[model samples]
Target: EDQVTQSPEALRLQEGESSSLNCSYTVSGLRGLFWYRQDPGKGPEFLFTLYSAGEEKEKERLKATLTKKESFLHITAPKPEDSATYLCAVQGVTGFQKLVFGTGTRLLVSP
Candidate 1:
């Protein structure tokens, strides 16, 4: 079975503080790793997709990196507006449309 585990279930940061969130996974064969952001009462918003190891993507204060075993979401100089639940998911070669997801890391940024 494919599985994902995210660390530190929750994180607290001061405004402008930087940090990285971890997503570890085990799959039969990795097709893609996905990153998402979700605000309270809203659906998750797609952030990045990594297809191979050493691949990276970035937008504003957030950067996503993928490796063979895990992925990381780096937040640089985060602001209160950047706080959200960050989710990680993966699609395995066996299941083209099936995604296994971690519970997510809840990030709270205080000014």
Candidate 2:
């Protein structure tokens, strides 16, 4: 079975503090790794997609990196507005291409 685990469950940061959130996975065959940011009541918002090891994507204060077994979401100098539930999902080489998602990391940035 494909599985995903996100660390720390929750994180607290001060404005301008930087940290990285982890997403570890085990799959039969990796198709893609995805990152998402979700607010309290809204659905997840797509952030990045990594298809192969060593691939990386960046947007504003967030950077996403992928390795063979895990991915990381690096947040640099975060602000209060950057606080959200960060999600990690993976797609394997199955017929349905279903996505296995982690519980997510809740990030709270206080000014």
State model 2's lDDT: 0.95
lDDT of 1 by residue, 1-111 (tens): 999999879999999999999999999999999998999999999999999999999999999999999999999999999889999999999976798999999999999
TM-score of 2: 0.97
Off by over 4 Å in 2: none
Write model 2 residue lDDT over 6-111, tens digit each, in one string. Answer: 9879999999999999999999899999999999999999999999999999999999999999999999999999999999999999847788999999999999
Task: Kindly report which residue stretches of model 1 are placed more than 4 angstroms away from their true locations once superposed.
Answer: none
lDDT of 1 at 84: 92
Q: How many residue pairs clash per model? A: 0, 0
Name every residue pair that clashes in candidate 1: none
